[model samples]
Target: MQEFAKKPTAHRHPLPHGTLTLTTNASSMVMCAVLEQDTDDCCQLLAFFGKKLTSVEQKYSAFDRELLEVHRTIHHFHHMLEGRQFVMQRDHQPLVRSFAKTADAWSAQQQHHLSAIAEHSCTIKHLKVEPLPTSEEYRYLFTIINRSTRWPKAQPIWQQKAESCMKALIGWVSRHGVPYIITSSSWGVNFMSTLWNSLADNLGAKIIHTTAYSPEANGIIKRLHRSLKASLTARFQGGIWRKELPLVLLGLKTSPHTALNISPAEALYGQSLTLPADTFQHTMSPASPSDNRKAFERIMPAKATYHIARKVYIPNELQNAEYAFIWVDAHRIPPHSPDYLGS
Candidate 1:
């Protein structure tokens, strides 16, 4: 019981002889799970999660909901169970046979979620007993945690900010689509405004504000800004920093972020931008047809692997096409109006 209560630490080394155990339960509009690894009759709890179902999800039957709990728990611990087979213990007996059979009668949403979980190698075991004490404790903790937390009441991220900031955020959303959340300072310019109400009414974004004067709250962004300023001062010296800021920002955006394993631009756009260094490689003489063929053969397998990993699909026609025209949005074109470019 003490071991089950202790939070699991990441395994420094893979367990050569152990079985990953997952137990899940669902009731009404809530679900929870208890993850453990068993070796030599000893079981160690790995992690647990509890979540309230969405309105659409609440419509699902008890059986489907139980399967959803299984799917969600497997997804949460995928890293530990990726290549290895694991045992899934569910309180619901019907799911054991249901999942074994074809998913012809499953709802599209359930099917979609189940398909992702199915890719993981695992066997489902139906528990003959009632819900475990750990699972029940998790549910109690989840409910209490959900109630005690100050959940943001508004539907949108920009729900409570000044008109200027609201307009800036709206413009950002218009261009980039809705962000997962908007972080801002708890200042008069952000907190006291009617535009925030409008934002909540229009676009629902999760807005989080930092404590005033708390540098530690947004330390990463602050540190990066300081670094950028230092770099600009060193590179530009006595020149106007504003004049060179865009180029510096572009360089920073294209450069890899140590924590993310990708550039800021790539994180936002899902692809890396073509910088000057990319063009530098193309300046050399073109390869002969035979050399190109050899290069293609060498790179084809890796390219195929990359596409599969990224879940990117290219049509046969597009892949074989000699020329491809990527349509750019009119608003993104320089000088918005064609005549403004002095044409």
Candidate 2:
């Protein structure tokens, strides 16, 4: 056998310019997509809009309209995703600030939708929009996340009142388990701090808030929202938002989680939950020895040996009804005739 000599290995080259890096800043809006490894046939859509709407009507006038639009868009987007995953990013600071001061009077339906969205993991960050240096274009700075494997389905809740926001958050925590942590931008720090102060007393859970303007910290959740939005948009075309919201949510619950390779419902429940279908049926066999024995006993009759013994004595009594017995000594002399012996 001939031995081969080792050759010198070449050094690896550094990443080229414009190459994407995983450790991007989190203070801006990020758009993440969720796609299957095998095929792109099934796609979901999610986007985080962090634009600040300014109006001349009043200081708080833009609050209600902008909030309503956000809710409407989210509802519409969910329908579009249908059965896929997506992510969306939002400016953490302003988003939380808006919620802290303006979200106390939301309607019941709005609260429900908001709470549902808030259940997911998210990050807070500052998104600064500036004008282009020389052109008429504007510079939009935001964050984007892809493939948030651990966290999924994040929702943004903006309220003007801190107390109200805390109440709503507590309700969400009660319904759904607590998240790993709470993240927000610089503006959100105060609100989160106040919120966390009462977490143990009100929510019964510890809430650790992340640094301001660093959304990449909660990348998983942001990516999930993007995938969810994309799927919703593609699935529901020109459908009524209110009518399709529930269906979209159901699709998410039933869809399989990529990381765990199981549906959320199954992971949470330990067993797969059944959906409504006419053809669906289940047949279970007895599992334990006692169960099997009980099943067999149900099909057999009870034995009655005591009743049989009593029945046999009745026949013997009827056959010997006319018979009578008399005792006689061994020294009897007359044995020829029965009547003479007796006399």
Per-model TM-score on C-alpha atoms: 0.34, 0.34
Compared with the true structure, what per-residue lDDT tens digits does model 2 show for residues 1-343? 1233355333233222211111112212222222111223422222333333334312333334433444444554454433333233343344445444554777665576466545433222344543222212212112211122222332232333455456555555665566444443334434545554676445445444444444555545455556666665655554433344446555665667655565555455544456665247676664798865654443222221121112223455656677544344233656652432221
Please estimate how well model 2 matches the true structure, expressed as its whole-model Cα lDDT: 0.41
Candidate 1 displacement at residue 209 in angstroms: 53
Quote model 2's TM-score. 0.34
Candidate 1 per-residue lDDT over residues 1-343, each given as its tens digit: 6686587666434475678888888966699987788877678767777999998888787777887788887778788788998888876878887767864887787788778878988888888853212221121100000111111111112222365456555655665566556555455454435567458546876666765545555444454655565666655644444455556767776776654445656555545578876887746586798976664443211110111122347788987877766543235545553433221
Where model 1 places Cα greater than 4 Å from the true spot, the runs are 1-16, 130-343
Each model's lDDT comes to 0.60, 0.41
Identify the candidate with maximal lDDT: 1
